[model samples]
Target: MAAGDPNHVLHVARGIEPTEALAVLGAKPGLIRTCELPDSKPDEWTSLPCAALGIQPGTAAALLAGRIGEWTFVYDDLGFTCDDSATMALSADGRTAATSVFTINADASLLYAVGGEQVEWVNVDDLNLEEDLPGMPAELRAAFEAAGNVPTEDLEPGEADGDIGMRAACALAGLALTLEDVRRIPLLVVPFG
Candidate 1:
């Protein structure tokens, strides 16, 4: 929930390149900015001060994206609120999964879309996996079930249940970020409106 930590994680199905994904998210190609990940471990990238990357704290909207196996993962430090129509557009051709968490306001949601249509939207924090998991997409439900056993074990201090659920959804959507994966992949930095 820190300033530079990811607040929104979006996954677009494989075959959609980072630029294309950004286009879907409303980023203008000419206006977009690019930056290389600092010469540091991948895990350290998120923790690095935003100023190091020229991101104005609490003002600029930037997105870092990279392809990972079956999906392209887009990480945003500031929670970019996309409306339902835009969310559906991002998944027009294939599948898309988006997870957002804003701990300061206790707000979070996991959204799944396929072929330009929304299939699921879950208020992660309010979910009681035991009662709601069955209605979610199979992959997401399974992840949530797996995460239910040890909710806060892997989380940093002060993280909420919503963070756990959001992470589970992201992982299920092929966003299980790892140091090596992050290191080898060059993320595209796109300036968002």
Candidate 2:
């Protein structure tokens, strides 16, 4: 989508302030005027960040993204959100978590599970992606960059509560990591039959 592409234009709805709502879709300054509005929230906005979108108790997506280029894929009532790669820690309650969303299948459930990676000790120097799009922290991004296996236990205690938080998961079989080093991996707790 070019700066002025038609499909790339902001899709605003009533009370959504057509010209002003473009920021919610990350459109350029002048591009606001070129928006082709929709009757409701755009189909592209899968899951927006509640904290980043300024979601109030009684507010809806329309009011939320009216002016905010809302962060999507954040942990919410929605289950199991993550970046492109399924790397990261889980919530204390054992839910699949992420700083953003990917191709999420809404019906799937996590029974009792945790995340792990084939690699540990990710090189802290090589991770570079679209930061402007919002994502997980660099520390968690680095821990999974090494050569190894997954760790099902003892993920170093870290923070997986809010966006940009981390929790470590130490290696179990051959995974070499400290408590503060496991956030670089993706995890969940799915109950097995």
Candidate 3:
């Protein structure tokens, strides 16, 4: 803790915004900090350092290399691709009613398989349950509860892919796989906000 650091206790205990916490400590709003980016971009802003925004080297490369809109991102190495910013996410249960089975690759990369099917993510890391999942879609959670663990063979060949079945088996054994298990897991891990 420093004399000018935002009072973490006050911020957490009072449930006040970091800026307000800084105000209590008599720090400038501009100088007070948060790990999350500003929800809405400011109309007028000064260019900050690339390191300041804290983006991943790969993602920054995608932006700088002009591949932000292409299928050429590192995600290819992990085996699946997305044409759009994802509209839904899987719960830690690693299941989704979407068209693909999302899993994590050996290097902790993300992977996916597409086909209209009941999908569940997998982990090459271990057959363990995850302690945290960034988020889960409402539908995915609903479908998981409805389906339960009905055995992979019961899912059928056209029902889902093999990778999903393996992942589900691991989940059944209490493992938690992460999106990063697939290549290019969608997170800006470099730095910022």
TM-score of each: 0.77, 0.16, 0.18
Candidate with better TM-score, 2 vs 3: 3
TM-score quality measure for candidate 3: 0.18
Q: What is the C-alpha lDDT profile of model 2 across 1-193, one tens digit per residue?
A: 1111111111112223323323323324442221222223222333222222333322322112222122111112222222223322222223222222211231111111124222222121222223311343443334223322233353333212111111122111123433223222321111101
- On TM-score, the leading prediction is 1
- Candidate 2 wrong stretches, greater than 4 Å: 1-90, 101-125, 128-193
Model 3: how large is the Cα RMSD against the reference? Answer: 18.1
Query: How does residue 142 of candidate 3 score in lDDT?
Result: 34
Ranking by TM-score: 1, 3, 2
What are the Cα lDDT values of the candidates?
0.61, 0.23, 0.25
Give the least accurate 10-residue stretch of model 2, judged by summed lDDT.
Answer: 1-10
Q: Write the per-residue lDDT of candidate 1 for residues 59-107, one digit (tens) a residue.
A: 6656676777767766666656446666577677766655444444656
* Displacement of the residue 77 alpha carbon in candidate 2, Å: 17
Please give the RMSD to the true structure for each candidate, in Å. Answer: 4.7, 18.9, 18.1
